[model samples]
Target: MMVGRDVQFAVDKKPCEVGKPILEVEDLVVPSKVHKNNAVRGVSFNVRAGEIVCVAGIDGNGQSELIYGITGLEKPTSGTIRLEGRDITNAPIRERSKAGMSHIPEDRHKHGLVLDYTLADNMVLQRYWQPEFQNHGFIKKNAVLQYAERLIKQYDVRSGQGPATIARSMSGGNQQKAIIAREVDKDPQLLVAVQPTRGLDVGAIEYIHKQIVAERDKGRAVLLVSLELDEVMNLSDRILVIYEGEIVGEFDPKKTTVEELGLYMAGAKKQGEAKA
Candidate 1:
């Protein structure tokens, strides 16, 4: 059994109604770049405010493609992605960010951080162009530094030279922390955290888990795409098992066993198939 440490950060947990979905993906399809078949086929789901919905399956089951489609990193072949009832299927990356979406991408090196940039600069990669951090097409260096300092402290992000350290020089866990700090601090309506705790130490994993839970408690919808069953079982309120480019079954984490979930993830059982 895995044990989680006490959460150090203070977050207000309030009751939030699970009515009215905040994000909806209907009949989504994503074609593979290197293959003839679609990467994701007719996938559909809705994430409500104040809930942590996890997409759980083995690696290479199209989970990454699904996230890419939703985050606008890759255009979908067909179907609609609605955020707060607004169709943003074909919106650009910045537009999705402006539409209240924050993503902790699966590949931190490629999608999360600018390795050559200083820690402070990477901290504001998504928001540096905003009015708060820029004026007259010039970045407000001091403001950016201050903001980075605050996040580093709040999220326990460590680096060799504080905010001046090069991002590539930081450890993986610290890099992940910086990404989380930037994304979560934005207070986005929907947070797409794909493998947020992929390769972190136990302490870091515990802290990230708390942060995710804290987000859900604050009435923000979190779409967690993780292959770790422990994280799926511990952090999510609902589980979606995706297999062969499709969702095979949905379950309440509290009501489903890992063994049963494993069966669905392996394509041994499906939503309508009879249980033996």
Candidate 2:
């Protein structure tokens, strides 16, 4: 949200600092098949710059579709996806990336990393075709290596062979950190941080959370989609619950009770009072 005057609640009492939303999703619908029924229907919300919006659902309730639709991995059947008031409803993945969007997928190994490539190569995976990493049609080895050194050092990515280490060789936590480092280093306007601390131990989870909030403090919008209820309650400024392909509830972390949210997450009942 961008207009400072639009913030209606006091920060001392509210979870969010209101403004014109950095990310506005309206009537967002995603159907699984070309002619199939909707996987996500009428899902909409606003993620203000410097805000962390979490979608907390158990699983199989269109959480994946919500993320995919927003990131251009899947096109919305009907919706307007806006960033900074610009309608980007039909933009391709690359176009979305250039416009400042980053997704840390739920399946990090499958959708995030290139196992065969070295950490350095994979760090620039999404942007390998760009001029900074390319000379003519070849990769600029020095530039990539330099950038990799900076990120690996900055993110504290530990691997047996350091920055030049192969992706498959590093531990899972380190590998995840590499992907995070690469994307976060880009200073994206909106970050789709899907389970940022999924498989990590307590220490790694703490580190990742700090990194996430740090990004928010720098005025970037973060959409955190996670099944871990504790993480959802802890990191999000606002939490949204998706049930049966629709958003059932929205709550401010400071005022809402997670125990009440647990009922909605378990699909026991719909929460109709809180609307995004």
Candidate 3:
């Protein structure tokens, strides 16, 4: 179990003029080895700096595949992924990370953390090779511990052994918190958080939500992929509803009702087509 103080922060509602696009996915298509058809088809969207654009849909609607493609875990059958106006469709995973992209993967155990590694080591998984954390191929263990301690304290990640704890021994909520701390601390230009608050307690949820909003306030573009209706409604400035691997509707969360959004998610409605 995780314990944290109640966090109350108002989401900024004032309309923000989105600046240059930080991420652009054009005509993205992902083929499935297990399925006959593509997992994602012709999906396109732009995430601008200082805005949070959410892709909302039910589970199994290509959200995971889309994230994999963007993060370079899986190759897209056809598409172009551009970061800050540079085409990075075929860039390697490390190349994308160095180009200012951070990901909080959906499956924490599978993709987010290396359970066997100490918390301090996992904290710098993406940056451990950098000059600050290494010297001529040797990892600066003290530097890693200091950085992990700061994040653990700041993010309220409690563990029996502190920074030395193996991540698998920590509670689920703390593990998620650790992932958030590590990814957010990177201060990436585009933060791709998929199902970030899933299966966590309310307190953890609140903390993570605030951190994501804080990122947008810092002029970072956020691409949120969540199936939770409440999270989609409360956190997103704009919502894109994906159904059967295609985006069928777009709405402003402030003006759309859950019932209407549900219609889109259920494939009962489309943005420009007549409702059945």
Candidate 4:
């Protein structure tokens, strides 16, 4: 639900609190042996049930590093990360995934999907090892196809061959759609969406935005990291502006200006760097 400039009298002032478990990061820090500096100086934030918190900032300022740190791709040097109150900071990547945290990496072509697999197969890749799509430790082909078809239609993937299409042959937009459709459909307690709408056309961007909001509406906690200024400004109920690997500002869209947001995003300003 988007609101205009005078958004106070808007609908649904109450935020959603359902879908999945809550995600909270406390004083997260990442060190760099290469640069001899903290890549993420000290970052902390929260993604509550049914809320989308967008991390807005310029690139080379640790935007990419932050998402990687959260997903266990890059182990943090310090701090605690919790999903539904379980400390996951030191947990391995697979553990985080099993804990119901799904991450759509920034480079979807490289990390989000497997080019060798068919779209339908890639859609259920996260769960192939699980029992729902498998029976007696054997993959149920028809059940897999059914699950993939449902997500493709629901998220609007429009390849000519539909869910059976090879991921390598799909258009960029369709690839993104397929990944989003799969990851979101998995219905994780915490969703790490990194630059999800980048390289997507306006229509695809719009569709993805609605889906993210829909997740929040359904009470899923989403940690969104995007370079699109308009996307972050429009979709985030609360904004966390990251600069130099640390969160520098926090604002309620109902109480902040885009210009003000730009300052924190660009490192021209830093409102506060308090603990979460």
75 Cα displacement, candidate 3 (Å): 0.2
Candidate structures ordered by TM-score, highest first:
3, 1, 2, 4
Q: Candidate 3, residues 49-94: lDDT per residue as tens digits?
A: 9999999998988998999999999999999999999888999999
By lDDT, the better pick of 1 and 3 is: 1
Model 1 clashes, total count: 0
Candidate 4 clash total?
3
What overall lDDT goes with each candidate model?
Answer: 0.91, 0.83, 0.91, 0.81
RMSD for each of the candidates: 3.1, 7.5, 2.0, 5.2
TM-score of each: 0.93, 0.89, 0.95, 0.87
Ranking of all candidate structures by their lDDT, best first: 1, 3, 2, 4
Give residue 99's error in model 3 in angstroms: 0.5
lDDT of 2 by residue, 1-276 (tens): 432334322222224454557899999989875347798999888999878999998778888888888888888889899988888889998888889898788887888998888999999987888999998999999999998999988999998787678898887788889989988987899999987788886656766787888888788899999988778877888899888788888898778887889888877767656545
Output the lDDT of residue 41, model 2. Answer: 92
* Top-TM-score candidate index: 3
| Residue 141, model 2: Cα distance from true site in angstroms | 0.7
On the 0 to 100 scale, the lDDT of residue 137 in model 3 is 100
